[model samples]
Target: MKIMIDAGHGPDTPGKRVPDDSMREYEFNSSTARRVVAALNDYKDVQVEITFEDTRDVPLKERTNKANAWEADLFVSIHANAVGDYWDDNVGGIETYVYLYPGTVAPKLAAIIQSKLIAYTGLRDRGVKQEDFHVLRETVMPAILCECGFMSNHHEADLLKADSYRQKSADAIVDGIAEFYGLSKDSPDLVPGNGNQTIDKGWWRKAMNLTIEQWRELAAELNRMYQDSVSGKIIPPVLNDYRWVEKAYKTEMTPEELLTVMSIIQMRRIV
Candidate 1:
């Protein structure tokens, strides 16, 4: 599924910062958005597009237009909330929003995100709300905007600045989306030469006499080979065999190619 992630506002956007000016809203938003993209990559059959930049504030119309043009399945806008650009110890919590007239799918998406955020962050549940935000209203797909915490609140501001909190927030958002769509993590099953058979993890340990760490190292090497193959730094042996075939393709390597690369790597290890 195609997902669009928007980091709300920009570095230069006026007044979207902590009262002490220690942190910008875009810093938190963009950081969390990036983490969300990386986390989502672990899921199979998922594609993500980020709609905002670090340098400039992208207009809401442009952000929604890009999602619409890409025909994205879902759109998520990430932001840090504030009230009146001043510090307040009392105002803090997590909230998520859908369009005022959100359709069936958007409300469900918003609820899932809201619940996950509160669960993971241990933040107060501000609950799901409806707003006529430009991104939510203009995007054709199901879209939701998340207000992670109030920048106006000093306590929440500190949490937003921490890497651990950003990571947890990103994970919660990805988990929510995955739950809604029933996404599975990429697994060895995506590898080609196993004849669609599920490999038992225990069997790999017994047959290869390799610890879990060793298996992970091997997988990491295979992943490097796949990256090299994709970048044209090196042609995977399997690809040379299919050079004569013509087919439409995405920028990402296909499952068959990835599987064949793994097979070749495994054979080399045995030899």
Candidate 2:
């Protein structure tokens, strides 16, 4: 499959920097886009190309033109979001967008990317949305525009700048594409862990050092939290706290923290 990856915006675009003016959106987008292309290239029979090869801002029309010319099977646009005119450290999450049309291939692709991104990055799910984004509307094939996280949020901005977080983002995209195509280890040139594992089992075993039974118990605790939230026993503030939980920052997690997060997600589900 041929995939077109568009790293949104150009390096010279004004006022697209992180809250501290430390990094440009293009810097994060381009770096992550390149990593995603590299990961997808590791798979067999997959061809990936970036919409813009350099830091220069290519017009939206030209970007779509190239994808259409290549006859790409999928188009993925990577971006970092800013909610307001000013920085807001508290606002953050992962969201994916498809064109504002029903029953399109874009929504499916967006949903796949959104779920994997939430699972791998441990970000709050802003959910899949319908938007009239140029990249989503103009692409000829299955297309999705992924807002990795809000750069205005300090914690998320730090993650966006980290190489480890970028790799995780790329890995999620690759996993989504592989799942959509049903690519497996047996496929020519396919890489390992392609839909074979959902969560990072190795990371869990190595970092958390928990046994299978312990993990199950933790999951059960999360379920109980969800039940409580649904029953309206948990107040709004407590619900909000658990709704935006993040535990996999750089894959560092204490057992207590992990359990808290697991419980939070469970609560989020029922609310």
Candidate 3:
């Protein structure tokens, strides 16, 4: 599949910087866009191209034109959002946008990317939205614009400046695209395992240093948490806490169990 990645805005774009002028929106967008290109390259049968190759703030028409001319299968535009030009701690989250009158594929792709971004970054779920963005409207193929975080929000501004956050955002975007297309990696190590492997209960017990009864108890607690989350009775855990949960039981978790854990984590409200 051919993918076009556009890092929104140019380095010199006016009023696109953080409140303190510490970082430009393109600085984050371009970095994350490059990471997305690098990750997509690892997948088989995938050809990736980035529109913002240099510092020039390319026009929206030119970017979309290139994608259309290239016959790209999909287009993704990366951006850091802002509320006005001032810092506001309360205004922050990640959101993805499709054209106001998008085709079937654009909304689906937007939803996937939105979910992945929130799950991976533990950012606020601003949900998928409709917008009349130039990139979205002009691209012939399915297209999405991701607002990684609010640059006007102090906390998220710091996150946008961090390499780790940019990397996470890129990984989430790539994962979303791969999931939408069912793309597989060229490397063996990245391939998912078949589900038929037998679980060695004894080994897992040793690995987690927990007995069968203890494992059952933990599983029961996780199930309860999942149910509570489903019922909207409790906030979901943060991604870091979810990682700890996964690390604690990954050796023993069945595919089904793993899904349950992920559901619980994603459902948790980020504080």
Question: Which candidate number has the best TM-score?
Answer: 1
Task: Name model 2 segments beyond 4 Å from true.
Answer: 100-102, 185-271
lDDT of 1 by residue, 171-248 (tens): 799999999999998754323335554432322333334443333334334433433454577644433221111111
In model 1, which range of ten residues has the least summed lDDT? 242-251
Clashing residue pairs for model 1: none
At residue 234, candidate 1 shows an lDDT of 67
* Comparison by TM-score, 1 against 2, better one: 1
Query: Predicted candidate 3: what Cα RMSD to the true structure?
Result: 13.1
Off by over 4 Å in 1: 100-102, 188-271
Please give the lDDT score for candidate 3: 0.76
Per-residue lDDT of model 3, residues 32-130, tens digit only: 786676667667888877788454889889999999999999999999999988989998999999985523588888899999999999999999998
- The candidate with the higher lDDT, 2 or 3, is 3
